[model samples]
Target: MDLNYSPYDFGIHNDPYPVYARLREEAPVFRNEPDDVWVLSRHADVQAALRDSATFSSVNGLRIEPAFWGPDAERFFSFVAMDPPRHTRVRGLVSRAFTHRRVQELEPRLRELARAYLDPLLDGEPFDLMTDFAGPFLADVISELVGVPEADRGEVRRLGAAIMYRDEESTDLPPEALQAIGALVGYYAELTRERARGRRDDLLSGLLDAAEGDDRLTLEEIVGVAILLVGAGIETSMLTLGNAWYAAWRHPDQRARAFDGRVADWIEETLRYDPPPQALARTTTAEVELHGTTLPAQSRVLLLIGSANRDPRVFPDPDRFDLDRDTGSSLAFGSGRHHCLGANLGRLETRIALEEIVKVVADYDIDTDGLRRIHSTNNRGFATLPTNVTARR
Candidate 1:
């Protein structure tokens, strides 16, 4: 496609690694003039931009949007999108609650949840893992962490999925997404009051109580952060579980090798191979020169994350989805200040889910024709992945 990459282009968005590899060699610093955004495909370039946050600001937040995508139809901003001090402060406040220990403590809960979801399906039947297992499993975990009432978890999942799976081709949000966002905002807005009224040992309660002297988060900000947490919580695990399993089934040998110690390896490879987040955009603060090209001030550059993860320089035999591929510190969760905050949680969720899947599911085959690729700007994965599984017992 002549280095003029359009994320809206269905074929490229679904599998842009090849084009990214080509661009890494031929046009490492290419520009999509139509979209008015620069493209960075190589690992070094993407990493450099990520590290040099001073030069490339993130005032734009985590809204790494597509050209034709909608306005801030459902604006939900968290610490993830902020720059420096603002990002630092908010992230610090929430980090106290989302600590590594908290995630570690969730291990048993995650394991139990995995079994709870998968065990019922182990009744020798075909099921859409996205709908029946992965989706609900992640939804429940996120709900527990956020302290959402059990009765309301289903509503939260439905709303989160609405935001997760939107029409990418539109310049404005579809009616369904808008309605879902409205409901999410309303629910969280009410939940914020609920948490404020009484205290609990949950992230939502923690967020309600987090502070820096008198400069606490506003009600809107609290709701925004809550929505962001739920959506991010649901999206990553859901995508990783479904994609990792799908990729595993496609490769018999690697799938076989994935049963034990290599389960983490398999999940890591899946992150590098086909991360849910395909790309992210960073706006330049001033004119910067790279690769013999001058990008002017205020230019937005799309870090081809999917491409960077598969960049041949960093990962040998890049395109092949090999679980054994030794990739060094892949940018699957990004890097620097804006790195994914939930990296550990996502890995834990995927690992636990996969461990359970291989236990009861003897052998499963993907329903190729039933696969539905989600059409978000940067997020890539299945909307529906129908799989027919056989039980060991």
Candidate 2:
């Protein structure tokens, strides 16, 4: 467990699976310099830490480099930065709105949305599937679900990109990122106000209702939670959709299964092999020991989720993408109290998206000429996915 392994090194910000595997083998609890963070790379280790919230607290911060706007930014985003009890309270309210049944009920609507957005692109020649299909589709779903007016989806999406894409290393001054954050916060506040009329049945309405209860959410809390949900919901799904398409196009056999309604396994396999979320970070609120290393209070821990997902101990031939493989349970959605609440929703979107893509893309080729990776400490995804798709009919 060397103290010199930097995930930021090895060109990992672009792609880090190889480095992750090396870490798992050499330093399961590798301490990364540059960021002064300890990384947990093994599947079992990551899963255990995720479940053991007491040892590895998330309260201090869940993000790698805390936002530039002081601790208020952290406190405002308490739902994401809080631990157990409080986290459970706020998350429960939102989770109630996104129940399995609700997501399942939304499947047909999602499929319809997918076709409406993609069929035209499919009819035309080559196009960027990420922009044409995934991005728009995810934005539409999140906008509608969050009670944002259909007319405002474009503005919402623009703000979403600004907030989600802005990174610690973003050349734009901190003020620019803060400006983007403010605009999004303003929009969410307005949306909350609108949802307050009690005239909607979407998730936003549910959240507003929950906010009015005894253990109610503060106005800032409501706004922050809304911003997180709106941004996280859409961006994560967009990443999943992009990665799903990439996997199908790369693995033809898996792509064939996807078209035939037997691709859930493939989707699961892809999630295991290349999770949209590469890492999850937690801060130690109290001194704790991990893998013989003492993580002092206030120390940061980065769980290399992508590496854990590909751990050979858990997944045989972990690097290979096999639709038929039996991946018992993967770290794609993470594990523990903070495991992704929208995992089922993400799966539903991916399954239907691939189904529709298969129906249209008889043959497709990834235009690897110029693909860009989203620069971020946590989420692993593509910024732009170029593809040449052929019509099935």
Candidate 3:
């Protein structure tokens, strides 16, 4: 099979499993000339690239281009684009706020919040699950946790969305979108400054006070983290929950089994089956040999996370959506030092979501025509998943 994989193609986004399988079998280290990025479709190849951060640096900010590789990009991206010592310092500061214990403690409050958002939709009325529930829930959770003022949370999400709406193929940049990112950065910077003046009971305040001595994150670093938290925390969580529902509704047999202790398996399977973050880019630091091909130094490589999770070499019957599938090796949240920091938060949110859903909704039907797939190079999931939610009782 002559593999032609373009992340921007809507057809591929809609159902990329078949194409992913073909790439895994025929061209594990496929070159997507159209996008000017090398793609790693197989699990072994993607895992290798992720593990060797020195060879494939994140300093170029995932996907490389003139717009994102500019000087200011370093200040804006902070840790995500950094290599070692800097990445360690920033990650350490941010990690304190998202500890396993902290996430566990958030459960009670999250359950209450989940109930507040979900109770109204149990009236058998049509609800756009993605827009109405999943999206808002994640936005609210992350904003509240990060200490964004209640009045400003909505605006933050709006601006953040605009900033994140990237089209890798487009040459012209959207001024308004850039402005939105600018505004968001300023918003977080102010929050960071306020925390510096006097500590508040929030993540921003915690970051300001998080250090024994001179070792600490600068104002720009804090702001970068705030943006990172929001960007990385929301979309994947929102989509995972929405896609889980999409899966449950589409496969009742699996849904029935999910009511028991197996819901965790269902969630794990969903991550492997149809993850939100479909791909991420890494820049080659030096020339590297992959399979029989040589990836030149300074070239861009797009790691097809969605494709890798479905590699038949790693997973049998790769196309089938099975709740019982063993997903121990799934590359959903990724691997290596650059692995997702918000992975725990995402899993917690997803579990609580499914638990709440099973409580209120025993049977639901999807309006397939009402579904809208989000067209993004790095993300995959429905933008709108309309369902007539029914109450259990």
Q: Which candidate is the best by TM-score?
A: 1
Question: Could you tell me every candidate's TM-score relative to the true structure?
Answer: 0.93, 0.90, 0.93
Report how far off residue 379 is in candidate 1 (Å). Answer: 1.1
Q: Rate the local accuracy (lDDT) of all candidates.
A: 0.79, 0.73, 0.79
After superposition on all CA atoms, how large is the RMSD of candidate 2?
Answer: 2.8
Number of the candidate with higher TM-score, 2 or 3:
3
lDDT of 2 by residue, 189-298 (tens): 88788777665777667666664256666567677766676546777778877887788778888777776777688678878878888877776668877678777887
**Model 2 lDDT-worst window of ten:** 68-77
Error of 1 at 215 (Å): 4.2
How much is the lDDT of residue 81 in candidate 1? 66
Clashing pairs in 1: 61-81, 70-171
> Candidate 1: deviation at residue 110, Å?
2.2
Candidate 1 minimal-lDDT segment of 10 residues: 65-74
Tens digits of per-residue lDDT, candidate 1, 1-393, equal 545577656888667777876888999889887767788888889998888888887667544553222234225556666777877887877776678887788889888888988878877678898988888899888887778898898778787777666564542347787688789889989988999999888877877777778767777777877777665778878898888988888888888888645889999999999888887777788999998999999887888888888877788888788877775668888899878888888888888888888887777889889888877656778888998888777
Candidate 3 structure, TM-score to reference: 0.93
Q: Give the C-alpha miss distance for residue 204 in model 2, angstroms.
A: 1.5
